[model samples]
Target: MADDMTDNMLILSMISQVFALILRSSFLSGGLGDA
Candidate 1:
């Protein structure tokens, strides 16, 4: 049970990282385009 919980947490962390990167990239592109 503990192992399963740890796995779930790890997956969630990875997903959050990917989402943050995507958001950051889009913001950068939009800002550059405006300039």
Candidate 2:
């Protein structure tokens, strides 16, 4: 049970990080394009 919880937390953390990275990149690209 503990192992399963840890795995789930890790997966969630990875997904959140990926989402943040995508958002940051998109914002940067848009700013660069405007300039």
* Candidate 1 structure lDDT: 0.87
Total backbone collisions for each predicted model? 0, 0
Candidate 2: tens digits of C-alpha lDDT, residues 1-35? 99999999999999999989887887888854653
Q: Which ten residues in a row have the lowest lDDT in candidate 1?
A: 26-35
**Top TM-score hit:** 1
Give candidate 2 misplaced runs (Cα > 4 Å).
31-35
Candidate 2: lDDT of 15? 100
Clashing pairs in 1: none
TM-score of each: 0.82, 0.79
lDDT of each: 0.87, 0.88
Compute the lDDT of residue 20 as modeled in candidate 1.
91
How many angstroms is residue 33 displaced in model 1 relative to the true structure, after the best TM-score fit? 10
Candidate 2 overall Cα lDDT vs. reference?
0.88
